[model samples]
Target: MATISSTWRVFLLIILSLCPITLSATVVEDLKNLHPPPHFNSTILSNCLKNPSLRYCSSSPMMDFDEIFKFTIVASHLCNESKNPTCVETFPNVDLKNRPNIAPLYLSFDFFWKYCPLSIMSIDLSNNSMKGGFPTDVLYCTQIQSLDLSINAFSGDLPIQSFSPLTNLTFLNLSYNFFSEIKLSDSQFFKRFNSSSFLHSGALLDEKKFTLKAVILLVGFPILVILVVVCWVWLCFQRPDFLPRKLQRTRRFTPAILKAATAGFSNNNLVGMSDVVHIYKGILRDGTEVKIEMYWDDIPRDSYRRFVEECKVLSRLHHKNLVRVLGWCRSRKFRAIITEWTEEENVEMWLSRSGPSWNHRLKVLKGVVECMRYLQEEWPEVNYELKTNTILLSDYMEPLISRFKVGDQTSNRKKIYRFGVFLLEMIQNKKGQEEFDRSYGEFIKYITTLDPADLHKMIDHRMEVTETNFHQVKQVLSLGFMCIDQSNNERPSLATIFNIIARAYKVSLVLPSTNHRIFHGERFKGHMPVQIK
Candidate 1:
């Protein structure tokens, strides 16, 4: 009887082991629980769509496009349903019919560079869970005709070389990636309007045509609008103006002075921007270096006033971790803002280097947090436009936040909504503005109020899984999540954030997490900036 009972127990155990296990939720449900993450794969289209709020570390095969007629998920794997109605917006189905011989390719943002460098034709990486930059090496796939990389976490300038190689690319929509510009090197600039491929559609139009239309409007608009602006300017110059100016009088530069500083508007001074204004390196007579940036549009004129206001606010902010706005210049044909120049380089360029180590990332993060604390406390209505490029390493690897402009205090709730945006970029290891802004919007709506651990998932994956490192840093990321709550009432006050950071992270909490970290078995060596050592 005892033997029979033991045998029955064994049989029950076998039965239990053979039974299928049930899962309460999948990654999609997991993502939905947090700050509204980005709509990946168009949610309506690509199966590989990555979370806008998080930078998924790697990419994998998605479902076949033909499989969308059934459920979207296939065997717990991602598959594309090419026949879906929504795909018409990005890639016209015509490309699929024309390229019949081109077999389906798996283009992951991480591993695609190694396995499929350039042969991929008619591939769609759109709205998928891709992290990292536009695979410049994919440019080698000179045959790729239709490429849709929209709404993923691709950061940095899409290599001019990468796009330059795709002579056959008819449908190139990089929308929603953290790309700043489609630079026009003398060899590349597509003139055809049908190229339909771009960051913002406005960038793709013939500049000359757009300028003609803009001039026609400007020249066509009634002079009364100009008169009102002139009157507004006169009132601004007067000691007592109608609106109370929050500005404490400081040294201001005129437009001519700025032109002289920039060598008479030379193209040599044109820096770059992934989202904000372009920066130029300027040298004064005494040989002092001043960083100069011009807001792109000057014709509308109201933009100039807004820039002036932004500069005034920045001038008042005095912080070691924040860039110091020296002043701004307003000229009839030109406008410019001046600030402190750094030799340490922007985060993007540094990361592009052979050695922007994880140590550097951590060091930069500490400086960024310091700047954040200052902005939350010292600056009023501060907008944390935290991008990899905006976070500059000072001579000592201290991250200095550049480009402060004043925004409406009443709009702080909307502005703070960008905090989730910053967290999104950090998670994806993306370093551009567009992705930052989209994710910002996503978090404001969906992710900010979720339980903090859900928010923690947005931390950069490059960091190792250590208690004091990635884990605790994620706890701090939750604080960022708190600060960006849509309801200002729901947001954590700066004091509360400070107290929380103080408790969760030690004085030595920050450690770099850039590509420069060299792994040696279990240990990693940190690399300093070229300017440093």
Candidate 2:
């Protein structure tokens, strides 16, 4: 009787093992039968079933199929037809005849919306040759967090009403579309998006009917042009060298031109001033606004050399987060670096004004880290003068790292420590700012003693912290502490720091292997020690 029972138990286990396979096959069939069917081939269906997120799905064959059956069964259970429609009724029947090679997986959006709208968090249909007007039906998926419809032939005005219901939609991309007319100026719903969201789209500007303003411009434009030309001709004759020199060097602006642009370095034009340099807001003859960083005469010779080195670096360095170097002027009496002007406030000013959301703050942190990583990888010799004051915000609230001052020869670990201080200041809100005003040693001492439970006290009260993001916040604090460790060997490498932070935020970052070999003559070191994972 015992032997028979044991045999029966084994039989039951075998049946249970096959149950998932049976369920997956059934789900795949059901998915195939839905109206405007997913039309997935065995391979695509298998891939989709395994990873409903479609993260592992690729064009290549010889793919891993071990999880395919298992995932299909899970997806099938999640997409039970009894709860919702088998397919979204809104999506039209795909024209298989026109595009026979089209993958059934492409229609996964349909299945996702119909069966698991709540699970649908992001939709990226960018650069897919998608045509016709914006797919307003997508907005019906209320749980969607991000929507990318860029690089498509989508036309007509964006349905603003549809967005009103999408409270969870934080990211909306409509760039490189043929949208004809979209008036988002007054719409509170559309205010969340930046100008870049609607860039390279016809909807940027609607057809404007000629009005009294247009007529006034038409009548007064020629007179204005004539007066400008007359003044230019008078200036050219009176000060021939002045006008010629300005015209000849369009790329490089002279000190005299920069002086005039900044209203002869008027006090009103002064935007910022440091011990070594003064920053002035200026507008050139061509109506291009620029920031001029002028060095003080009292600046030491070493500081002057550092400025020149910085100019050389800035002229070559081109990153979205770094300020753009327009031109520079170096002479006996004058030394200045001109860059593209931005009217937006710095991180310090922005923080003072109620601060930003956790998401924006994280973005700023990420940008600063990326800039640091780039500098480390490209020019390990150069170090950034990173601080809240040095970091400016763009119109879209993107963080721009500025002020690349030459530093005394220091280990990369020390630079990382400084970055940690900066990051801590960013996270700690008002207290951090006050700490920043105090000595670095004091800030380090205070932070080291801070209890994990008291981290909330350090964070900005304006930003909400929930259980979902509590781990991420803590991770950042932990990273800051690790980075600011007194023992250089205890500190993590920039790559390791970046990886940890990226993983905490659920962002993917590929870093080069830290292990390397060095050979000198017959002697060779098999591997250099590196604290990076």
> 175-285 in candidate 1: lDDT tens per residue?
655654443423344553244465452333457776897897888676768887887676455322133545423447655455566797677976665344667787754
Candidate 2, residues 1-533, lDDT tens digits: the string is 33323322332233235445543454455444422212223644553564454433442564444333333333443333223233121111121222212322333344333333234466666666667777765665666778777777788777887788788778878888898765677788668888788778766654353356576699889889999999887655332325755465433556667778889899999988988889999988768888998886756789777776676766777778888787677666768889889865899888778677566777788878888888777767666677888889888777787777445556788788888888777777576647567677876787667654344446666655444454466677778877888765778788887777667545312222232323223222333221111
The model with the greatest lDDT is: 2
Q: Local error of candidate 2 at 7, Å?
A: 99
Q: Of the candidates shown, which would achieve the greatest TM-score relative to the real structure?
A: 2
What lDDT is obtained when candidate 2 is compared to the true structure?
0.63
**Would you list the C-alpha lDDT of every candidate in the order shown?**
0.50, 0.63
lDDT assessment of candidate 1? 0.50
Error of 1 at 187 (Å): 90
